[model samples]
Target: MSCCTPGSSRGGNSSDAAAVPGPTWRQNTTATASGETVQVPVPLAAGEFDMGDNFGEGYPADGETPVHRVALSAFLVDPTAVTNGEFAAFVDATGYVTDAERYGSSAVFHLALDPSDTAICGWAAHARWWLEVRGACWHRPEGPRSDIEGRRDHPVVHVSHRDALAYCAWAGKRLLTEAEWEYAARGGHEARRYPWGDALAPAGVHQCNIWHGRFPVHNTLEDGYLTTAPAKSFHRNDYGLWSMVGNVWEWCADWFSPHYYRRSPQQDPRGAPFGMARVMRGGSYLCHDSYCHRYRVAARSSNTPNSSSGNLGFRCAADDSSLSFGDPAAPQ
Candidate 1:
């Protein structure tokens, strides 16, 4: 289920493999947030990297191939995924209700549907099962059965673009420009297939959250999370960022179009002028090669600004001088 598509770059055996070094696995220097929850500040190292992939590991519709170089200015990012507690704070401050709650329903994955069903959603309906349930939102992550009370550290999900935008505005931060996201996710490595390296099986260990067994019917859960994990559960990127891939799809500031990257400039390009959907980076826990696999660093996907579901969430980024990226006493 790798995301590679036609014309994407494939690793040249051991050449690309030998070229890049893995992440430093730095110790956590937690920065207590302004509230009760603690958030680590991810120090963003400024640099450039070849963006996108030409390998066979991306989705065709994802438009992540034809890899190109992109330059981004330095900016700080949250070291961990946005948590329920933080999002709750945003809600309290802004009184925001996500699109899912407003619309009273959102797209639910359904793998089998009548082909002639005029109401059938596009790719979202490709899943084995999905239902349009009311009250499904960030608070009620999986319709009526889920709640966020105990999982304050887990990345918030079922968030729409509107929700993310509200949180960003309240936090005095902005969504990472597409260039900034890809570069940061690459963890300062140039031409590495993933943030870690070319090999998907790095040191016989799974690098990120992805499906391990038969997609819908079975999951090995080898990485220890069936759905989402605490934002800092796994290893961090070189910049100390967590959950850059898999777990949840993060909303970006730019509107989405398939060819946006092709026409976009290499320097801090955002995205298209306007589209029905905004660009969403990273991939969700549900991504699988048998289905959607747009989780690569260069990978891209789009969802309507108003759409919210069980799989979508976001993180906030701030200016470099913000003192919030981690403890100043903490080693880089």
Candidate 2:
């Protein structure tokens, strides 16, 4: 696991397997009362763009170097991360279970926990800020006591890579490739530190959700968010995409390899063929420059496929043929 995010080490028990009876569940494409889907994907026309970090600001070990040109076919991506309410609809329809729920625990930031809920079963040795809290699933974000009653619009967390794939399958979408993710996140910008520009906060404005104070200790909430903000709280990029670099780390559809960039294909690179962990893009709300400064557009990280955390979530993407004018999940 990366130091920025903790990965789950526990395996699912027999009881966990028994809880979810089937291997696959029904897909939920239900429309709203007004006949609109929960999300509308944004389309990016086919083009070639510079991929990876040219500046030396990123961690070299994570393979953010050797900036290369990448050509990609047209694709559609979700404007924002998947919300708790949307995930709830899928669970309600298919009775699908998340990896965190299956494992009976997930990694949660220490600061997000309340003083009363002391059910921390484990901790990341290198980064003590992460706590393996029991019953920390999608609905119960912080733990058993915490619920998504008023946070339905917030991006859903505690979803593993497999769980994200399950959601994509049910929604008739797929996870974005690392190259595609960077392309959409760039939002037509070239070699810019962030989706907006080089400045972290231009003209004294908090553009996105990130740590505003001391790391894992004092979060002044200068950006008005200690945890995650609303999925669409901040301004969109040049391509009209929201929260592309912060709020939560998004899962990508590629196996992680720190050295992949050295041998990456120039045309729509799909990442490594096989690996121990998968790629995670965009930093989360816990990101602090003093510690994890991976909030940049080209920054990358990875974790085991079965691992999940409170600050980890994902969005979906699809090819042009899979989307239509009347498709609720497609771009309007």
Candidate 3:
């Protein structure tokens, strides 16, 4: 986890690592039927967008291990992530209990030190994270101290894959498949490093709200944010999607297998037959070059679907035309 940044490229020297900006918020222009229910309105994201790397600015991880081609018809997607307000609405509407809430705690990065000692301090955790912190659920981001009263626009955190599944079921949408996610992220272009082209950071333009200067100890705020920013803080990709590379590790629908790419079909390969963990992509705001540079488009990561954290969240997706999930009569 410390060795990978969400969007870092290992090799394949790129001359255009400064072409496009990172994902920023896109407008929620699609209108929805008026309803008192707290529902996410998804829009038709039509056209066949390319998936996987072409410029060699991505990592070769399982699932993303192979650089394959896929042609997907247009679909609909939520303009932004599922927000605190939205999740609250879901919980209110249904007695759904998130895994984090049911377990009574979740993993937190334990920055252990003697406080008086400077020898064990570093951005990259010298040891393993996933410390079991009691009362560490989504509502209480910092263990009963934080609340979502003023963060309605921020993406919801500490939700499990099952929770996301429930939300999708109730909202008349579903989570984006890994291939679909990449296609939407790329807009219409072949993969470069990010949702944008081959640029890590464009000159004079701060793309994603990543960290700057010395991490942990010193933060320069070059991206106008020390922590996470509003969902719309940076520029959108060609597909008009925001923060596709960073902010949180979005959970995809596919089960993970590091060797899945080796057997990935070119048409619409989902993932392995079965696995314990699900795929997490786009890295997160915690991403740093000195640590996890996994924000790259082709990079793949896996985690227990039930685990949650401050640096993880998700969005929703819908279908375009009259079809959903390849079935013309699929329910919306």
Candidate 4:
């Protein structure tokens, strides 16, 4: 197990790094049945997009090895990860309580600078950058002291896969299949390391949000954010999807198997039939090239369905047939 382990969504230990603002992107809008306005998902036309890592760019695991091509049906995807305010609206409508709230705890990443802080979860054995906090939840991502006060627009975190599914269920949306996710994330590009291109920083400009400094110790905040940023903070992909490669790890609908790509169906390949963990993609703010290199377009990770953390969140997806542009169908 490496620092980029697949089980937890701890945002990485950069809480003290400070949150800086960045540019925003264009978006479409829609209203839910409950009259709550939300960002309309962009439509991705039916096409083929490359999936998985193949640049001989192997990471701590072989999950993303052997880059492959996949064909997908057209679908609609949220332009941004679900925001705190959005999730709160869902909660208000459905009275849903998140897994973190029920469990009374969620994994949180705290810097190892304070010896006392390390005593809680005793530093993750595989990734020393994470810690499990007692009161951490999506509403209080960093713990009780941390609230989504000014972060209404930021991606909602500390949500387990179940929590995300609940939101999707209420919204009449579903988690994107891994293939669909990779296709949408690729943004019509061909084998580029990131959603933008091969360059991590094109022309010395930061495109997405990821660690800008040393891993686990220092965060330079070069991208203008230490932790989660507004879902649309950075530039969007060619498909108009914002922060596709970072900010938070978006959950996928497939069960995770490192080698599942080997036998995955060529067209609209879904993951294994059943597994202990679901796929997570696009990495999080904690991602740094020095350790967790999962911020790439083809990188992959996973966590159990019940797992929750400060960096784990999700975006909603729906079949093209279901979306009606001006008004979406109510959840069944």
Model 4's TM-score against the true structure: 0.86
Per-residue C-alpha lDDT of model 4 across residues 1-332, encoded as one tens digit per residue? 23543364434321111222221212343554455458766778899866778576756454786667788888888888999988887877767777778767776776512345422544466765777676778888877666889998899998877787777766667899988888888889888888899999989998888887778778888888878898878688888888889888998998888889888887888899887788888998888878778898888888777777778799888888775555543211
Q: For residue 87, give model 1's deviation from the true position in Å.
A: 0.8
- Residue 86, candidate 3: alpha-carbon lDDT: 70
Local distance difference test scores for all models? 0.64, 0.84, 0.61, 0.76
Best by TM-score: 2
Q: Which ten residues in a row have the lowest lDDT in candidate 1?
A: 8-17
lDDT score of residue 313 within candidate 1: 77
Clashes of 1: 14
Query: TM-score of every model?
Result: 0.79, 0.91, 0.76, 0.86
Any idea what lDDT model 2 has? Answer: 0.84
Q: What is the lDDT for 271 in model 1?
A: 82
Model 3 lDDT per residue over 264-325, tens place: 66665677778767777787766777755677777777766665666677778765642323
Q: Sorted on TM-score, highest at the top, how do the candidates line up?
A: 2, 4, 1, 3
Residue 236, model 1, lDDT: 76
Candidate 3 regions exceeding 4 Å error are 1-50, 54-63, 109-131, 321-332
Better lDDT candidate (2, 4): 2
